[model samples]
Target: MILAKKKQRDFHQLSTPWNVVFNLFAGIFAFLCVFPFLFVVIISLTDEGTLAREGYRLIPSEWSFEAYKYVFQTGDTLLRSYGVTIFVTVVGTIISLLFIAFYSYAISRKSFKYRNFFSFFAFFTMLFNGGLVPTYIVVTQLLGLKDTIWSLILPLAVNAFYIMILRTFYSTSVPDAIIESGKIDGAGEFGTFIRLVLPLSLPGLATIALFSTLGYWNDWFNALLYIDNPNLVPLQSMLMRIETNLQFILQNSQNSSLGLEALRNMPQDTSRMAMVVLATGPIIFAYPFFQRYFIQGLTVGAVKE
Candidate 1:
């Protein structure tokens, strides 16, 4: 009865006029946030002639699919790069989440014999690193991961910062009594972690998963350094190469009036927007699936005695 009364009291605290003002401002804020991407989509659909003649517009007088058409022209290469990127993102995010969870969970436990030592071990790496040349030699020479997908995955798989975040989250958000109870129920370390701890830690795990997913999706430098095979090139690397080649073509074009007009007709600006849409659309859609867990993870053990 008190809980229901508290809920009712809170609901009435807003007042109708205040609620209207809050919602009005929130709607405007949301529109402002979303308008840039909408503008990009409109630009991608605008005809090259219209774009060149007029500046960017919310509604173009003419529309064309030339940008998308050009992107799709390399159908086989596009599909292959897309497959490689998806595979890398999925596999990398899973591996990253598992490693982070285990390492963080291990270090967060006060009962662990080497908790402080392992905690310092991860922290020490955050302060210093063997420079790129030496690190490169290790991966390429010692590990023989060069020109392989493992090179991409292994390079970025473990982040010290992510381990720290998960460790803090686990410490503050998981109560000791619960683990004792699980132990009392005859659960082992792995069993208690899987059955009790993981269920309560979804929000923290979800946050890390989203970060890892974005890191893998947008990575091109790793592909540039480690992947030499054409077939192993991921989407971002392929897109970078496409943009570079396009710029080269534009630079070497004829320098005359007709040539300038031809340049105007080419899908430079529009193609960029098309690429932006293609690259970002999937990740944008993915954010909503993880949104609920990100903040709610903070509240996990708040009510515990």
Candidate 2:
């Protein structure tokens, strides 16, 4: 009875300090992550004149939603860009996940004759690539993907690192006994993969899917390089244009009948903040939904058996 009480006391003593330290670090990191977003939100809602008078602050001196109102005034441009981003993210993630999953599965199979050779081929691309100009020419001139949504989706559809990670996961986690059992049950190679392998690899798939979706969603480079159509511009690129180019903002502001003078007087800085918040809204919302899956997937795939 005395020993048990001592053990219990020691456990409580150890846990108390650890819990305090953990909570302290977690709170600090959480504040660091959330502070910038809070500042952005506060600035976005601040009156333009107030922002011009005083730079950004955690709390706005005068609150107003004019920037958001101005953004939604036309609404079509923003809405269209959002639609394009969504379409590309969905389509690109699906294509990338399918290709990576199939290729990884093939490479993970020990009996596959050319697995090593194919793995080397895929891995080699990561080390060296045909440089930017040639790649651009091939994608734009040869493939004729310029100015289309395909320009955004096709070029970045396959990522080498993701494939490697998935391959490692399949090789480490999946048991050879299961495959042999499936074969004994009269399942063909394709059927075994479809029924047994893919189900077990969901964590790896979820991890890669999140990576692909983020890549597709945040990508402005492909659009900047190959896409010339204003209608096909993704939200990030549109936000970039609106924020960096005063003339474009002025032109957009003109459509509201506030005139150049009033727009100049308005909180240009606050509007930039508002535009950033608007552009990132979808990602902010979608991230939490996939976050649990992402964490689980990465943990499983990263562990070697």
Candidate 3:
């Protein structure tokens, strides 16, 4: 009893000063991570004249909603592009996750006859490619996926690095005993994969899902290459077009003495800040959901039986 009470007392000395120092360091680091977003939000709200005069600040001299208002002016076009972006992000992430998981699992199986060949096939693409022109031909001429939503998805569905990551994940995290147990239960290949393998592989799946979601969300190059129809352009592409048009208008407005300064004093700098916030806000929230699995995925293979 005396030893037990003494051990309890030893643990209650506030640990050490290092704990305080580490907490302080972490608090500062966290603030630094969040500061940029807060700064952008502030800049977006700053009055154009005040912003130009005083520059960016934690506390602006004046505030206005002009930047957000400018962004939302074309409501119908904004909503349509948002729909396209949402569809592409959701469907594309799902497709990429499925293909990646399936391919990785198949190749990870020791019983797979062509595991070496399939592994080589995925790895070889990491070092070499068919080039842009050939890929364009395949996408546009062969696949006939141009201007369709599938164009956004199919091109990015198979990533060599992602395949390798998940394949390694499967080999290390899933013990062979699990597979034997599934077989003993009379589960077929697909059934075992869906019911047993997948549940055990959530960490890897969520990690890949987060990556694929971000890739699809930020993909404007795909839209630029494949989508000619304005209606099909994703949100990032629409924002790029808006910036291009804004530049054009600003340049042409320069011909008139009061043109750039007029037009309700449009906030160009602040508008760009607003664009960043809008484009990134939804996706920023997605990270928290995947963070638990992402950490687990990264730390996989650290231990062995």
Candidate that scores best on lDDT: 1
Give all candidates' CA lDDT scores.
0.91, 0.85, 0.90
Question: Which of 1 and 2 is ahead in lDDT?
Answer: 1
Off by over 4 Å in 1: 1-12, 255-265, 298-305
TM-score for all models, in order of appearance: 0.92, 0.84, 0.91
Per-residue lDDT for 246 in model 1? 76
Off by over 4 Å in 2: 1-21, 247-263, 298-305
Q: Tell me the tens digit of each residue's lDDT in model 1 across 258-287.
A: 667657667999999999988888889989
RMSD (Å) per prediction? 2.7, 4.4, 2.9
* Candidate 1 least-lDDT 10 residues: 296-305
Cα lDDT of candidate 2 equals: 0.85
Residue-pair clashes per prediction, in order, are 0, 1, 0
Give lDDT tens digits, candidate 3, residues 1-305.
Answer: 99998988888666669789889999999999999998998999999889989988889879999999998987888889889989988998998999999999999999999999999999999999999889999999999999898998899987999999999989989998999899999999999999889998999899889889999999999889999988898999999988897888787896786775654478889999999999998899989999898787777777653
Task: List candidate 3 segments past 4 Å from native.
Answer: 1-16, 261-264, 298-305
Per-residue lDDT tens digits for candidate 2, residues 1-305, read: 99999997887675777889999999999999988887888889999888777877767678999888866654698899989999999999999998999999999898999999999999999999999999999999999999989999998889889999999989888999999999999999989999999888887888888889889999999999998899999988987776666556566876776666666755577777888788776777777777776667657646454
